[model samples]
Every structure is written in C-alpha cells, then in structure tokens.
Target: MTAVHLADLLTLGARPAAGLLLSLTDRCPLACAHCSTDSTMASAQSPGGPFRALVSSFTPDCRPELILMSGGEPLLRPALVRELTASAATAGTGAALLTGMFFARGGGRLPPAVRRAVTGLAHLAASLDAEHEREVGRAEVFRALGAALDHVPHASLHLTAVPDAAGHAYLDGVIADVRRRFGTRVPMLVGAVRPTGRAARRVPVHPPAGRGATGRGATAPCEFAHWPVVDQGGTVYACTRQSLLRGGPAPAHLVLGHAARDTWRTLSERTLGDPLLRSVRTLGPVTTRERYGPPPAADGCATRPGTPDPCGSCLALDPATADATARQFATPGGRAVEHTVLALAAARPPHRLAAARGTLPRYADLVELGWTG
Candidate 1:
C-alpha cells in the first residue's frame, strides 16, 4: 500500500488544503435543547469587526479550498454572509453554509447586498434532526428547502444521530423521511452526535456497543487534522473542535519584523508555528475509552460494552476534545493519510449506505491497504 501525504492529498484534489469553518454570528432564534454551540437568546450577539478581519485575512493565506460558514444561525447576518461568500468567491474558494433552515422559508429577509452574496454561494447545508424538526417545525423545513432550492442548485441536508435502541430506530426513520422528502434533489450526509456544549447538557453521551452510524463498531477516524479554524474573533485553532474547546480565545496577531520583506513571511510563519496548532496537527484516532470513561474521579476508568457514557463520545460541543482527538491522529506516517481516506469514503448519502453491503470492510481495507478499483 502506498502511503498518502497531506501535501500530496491537497495537490491531488483528494482533500482540501484547509477547510475553514467560520462562525458568521452566534444569534439563533431557536432554542433547541441539543444545540451544540450552547447558543441561546443571550449569546446571539455578533462579533462583527473581528469576524470581518478574520475573513479578510483568510482570503490571502493560501486561500482555503473549502470554507464552511456556520453559527447559532448564519441567516441572522444576511449582509455578512453575502460579504463573506463574495470574498470567498473572489478568492476562488468553494464555500458552503451550515444553517438550521429557519431563514430558508422567508429568504431570510436579507438585505440586498446579503441576498446577492447568498445567491453567489456554491451551496447551503441545512440541519435536519429530530430536535431540529421539533423546534423549527416541518412546515418551516419545507419552506426553507423551497427557498434554498429556488436560489442554490446544491443544498445539502446534514442529519445528526445518536446511538441507542430507540435513537437508532429514530435515525432510520429520519433517513427514510429525508429520502422521501428531498429524494435526489438534495444531497444528504449523516454523522454521529458529539457530546459537548448544550448537547452535552441535554443528551447523555455514549458510544453504540454494536453497529452504529459511524461505520458500525469501527471508530470514525479524524480526517480534519490539517484543517485550521478561524473564529469570529480572528482567533485561529487547528480545527473547529479545538476552537470550541478553548472557549473561543483570541489568537495573537501576526507579527512583523524589522525587515520589510520579512513582515508577511514572519507573520505567516508565526501563524503556522503556534504550539497549540502544532498539537492539533499531530492528533490521531482517539480511543473510545479515553473519551467515554468517567471523569478523573473514577478509579480504573474504562468503558464497558453496553454501558455507554453519554459524555465520552459527544464532541459536537467541546472544541477542546475535538482538537485533542485530531491531534491524536495526526501521525507523520501513512496512518493519518489512511485515516482521512477512510473517513471521506465512509461519508455516504443514505441511498448509498442503504444499497451497499460490506461498505465498512471495503473502507477499512482501502485505508489500511490502499485498495482501489
């Protein structure tokens, strides 16, 4: 098997150079119990100036290939969305939005500039989970879908699920319902729910003892290690989870040395050389036990089958845990490359997963042995 390197993966177009998950604003109208960002009515304020600067700085810094705009609800700042999307497009970046579909129905009453900006986006991704449906309502979901379809030809549906007897059943039904509703018009992606933030507060964190959404009993590998996250405050982290785990700290501004020519180089080097970031770049496949075991108080902490710890497997809210997981998998050898390939390959639409048997085996072999047809 040939080992794939991060550099080669980016150049070959198998992976993006860096995937930027920018939080446009933290204001969402809904107050779902499972909200991962811990967003609420009070925390919905926008970091306008700092966010603008971060986006501006990001454009020239190797220009990430994929930029995902998200927040408590990104539609709140229609104008900013437009500006960010336009900037990304101008810089030749492929952009997407992670939204709750709350604004999709009314076209978000966006300002003229923001509307124009959204129209230019490559795609809009809407969240559809049981909780989302309960809070936002199905009618609103259709309305948002209609709005999105009217604007962007590519709108993806992101479905998050947990592992449990009843939860698994609900997930299966959700997948069916999504297919029945959107069909082939909207692409869909499913993932496990990470325990963190509001979700951690509301939902119990635990891993599925048997076959589960993240490739059955097999652990899902962290492929986002090389990616860097730039928050609204211009604070950069190695990944989104890291940014969240750190409580959203502001990163030091890039430095400029005495030599005029060295200014940009020095700043860029410093940005890339941060120790916290370096730690993230070195993360790898985190053991399930490490994440799920009881807190430090427990003696001989370990996870047992059929006894899932709700806090361990959920990374949706905790940026720090996410960063740690990424760092654990960022091995220098072929392991990281293999893990990434497997992760991407495992990400399939519901139609594919339903039709395909032995997908997990093929994915595992492809990662461990580099098998391809």
Candidate 2:
C-alpha cells in the first residue's frame, strides 16, 4: 500500500500474478530497429472501446493489483490511457505506462495530451536502449523525462541492452547520469534484449533448458506465466514475452481469454483456478510435460542445454495431456510443491528476482537503482 517503485514491480513474478500487461496499440511513430514488438505505423491494432470495457469490469475485490500498459507506443492513445487509468482508480487497481517517449525527441515540455494522459497515474516508464537511441537522442530522452517527472506520482526508466561489454558500459553511464540528475527518486528496470519481434530473425532465441527423458524430473518452474499479457488485439496470453503472443495460434496452454468476451473476474479466476496453468506457473512448462506428459521429444521443446535450439518443451497441451496435468497438479503433493516453489522464489527482494529472470548479472545489481528498499 506504500508508494510503488519500479524495483517493486519487477519482483511481482515471485508472487501470485497481481499484474496484467495491456498493449494499447501496435502503431509506433518511431521505428526503433531492435524493437521486440515489431511495432510500426502500419501494424495492426485493436480498438480502445473493448479495452476500456475490459478494465471497466474490474471490482475492488477481484481485480489485478496492477495493470501495466505498453505498445509499439501506448502514448499514441492518450485519451484511452487517461480513461483506463481513471477507471483503475475507481477499482483501487494501480495503473502504469511504458513508452518509447516518441513525444520527447524534441525536448520541449511534454504535449498537453501526453501530460493529461499520464496525469494521476501511479507511474510512467521510458524506454531507452542502443536501438532507441538511434531514433531518439539520449539527451533529449533525459530532458523529456526531466519534464515528465512533474505530472506523475513516480517516474522510471526501462533500459534494454544486449549482454556484453558495451551493454554494461552504457548501463553504468546512464545509471550514473540518472543518479546525478534525479538522485534516488528515479528507479530502473533493466533487461536484456531477447530474440523477440524484429530481433528474432537476427538474434538467435533460446529458452533455458536441461536434458531429460521426461520433463517431470526437473523442478525449474516458470513464474513468467503469472502475469497475463493482453496484446493489441485484446487477446490475452499467459506471459509478457512478446514472442509468445505476436505469432502463430497461441499455444493452447498460454491463451487466457479475450478482453472483449471476458471480464476481470472470469480472467482472474481462470488464471488462478486452472490446474494446468497453475502447474506451469509452479513446475514450469518443461517439467509439467515431463511430470504429466509423454516422453520428451525434440519437437522444439527445450531439453538439455547442449541440445540445439532449446525452446520451451511444453508449448501446448493435447486433450489427454491436459487431463493428466489437471489431475496430477490437483493432488496434495502438487499443491505443496506449488506453495514451496512460489515461497522460495518470492523470498528475495525485487531486484534479485529481476536478476534471476534474465537481467544481466553485472548490471543486474543496478536494477535496484532507486528507492530505500
């Protein structure tokens, strides 16, 4: 109930999914080459009406604790942003926005529409990275953030860097700059560039894995499944990882529900009540397959690290497999493991959770950049 910090949100994965990520629009004015959403002015987007209706369904007792809005650039729909944020307030659900800061390039004061949209929200996050720098000057972005700090309750940066020497140097310098400028008032959520969106074709994408005849043997649970992500089409999926939602028929296991047809209560219940989903959240996809699945096959499912192209082993489920997953995860033993795994993962501070979930190790320490916590 205290003011929320960027570091605090990064750690939400360790707990029951209290957050939902809603992609406002796929249309971005700035074409950052390394973007994970592959957003463009021409890209498809869903209507704001359904999205508004969905958020309108939240009740004080059943709504998500947090709702994070992003897109090719969520600011493109400022009016909807303002509406949804106000609606969230009525339900006691906090709202936040993640933007590319397209409006910040020239470095004057923020446009009235952008300021009005972000006003009274819990937080605002600006995206800065090597790729984004090519489109928007770092100085300009910083200057814009400086101006934005006026209207919002809190402000932060979401930096994306590929892991390497250059990445660390950038993080160190930028973090230092932020510290000097904002002192500890600003916090950051630093992450590595994954093989998603435009980068997928260039950067080889690989999920973490281990070798096994049956995925059931390993205990690596996927906490990412906790936060349900709603794409621009109003379609909701289990994780925020863009790659999982942008293409193909959503692997059956990950599809939650569409915002148009489902209320917050229905979605939240499905998220928390489904045994298969709970298993994936607690035991991870691979181990869920191993525990309740047929012998592991190399069908793009992640296996031992040495195995080539270690993708998620349990991408989807068949009818019989879903049944087994439901039954097995329903048992007392399964419930025990779920609580234990969640407890262990949640035991750390928010920054530590960020470190374990793929933020660069050396610079990972900097994710705790602001806040006394």
Q: Using TM-score as the measure, which candidate wins?
A: 2
Q: What lDDT would each prediction earn against the true structure?
A: 0.48, 0.74
Q: Name the candidate that leads on lDDT.
A: 2
lDDT of 2 by residue, 1-373 (tens): 2146777777665666688889889999998877887889999887887688789999988888788899989999999999998898798888888999999877645889998998877878898888888888888888888888887767888887766778778878888888888887777778777766776665534343122122122445665678878889888887656565445566666788899989988887878777777877777766666667655565543434434221245555555677887787678887888888888878888767777676665666666766567
Q: Which regions of candidate 2 are displaced past 4 Å?
A: 204-219, 298-305, 308-311
Compose the digit string of candidate 1's lDDT tens values, residues 1-373: 0122112222222232344566766668777666777776577464566545544554454565656678878777778887777666665666667788665344334334434655766666678777777777665675656565666646656666565566667667765665677665554555555555566655664532211112232233333434444444444444445323445332231111222122223333543443333322222222333452223324221344443222223222244543543454465543555456545544543233322321222111111111121
Clashes of each: 24, 8
Weakest 10 consecutive residues of candidate 1 by summed lDDT: 362-371
lDDT of 1 at 69: 79
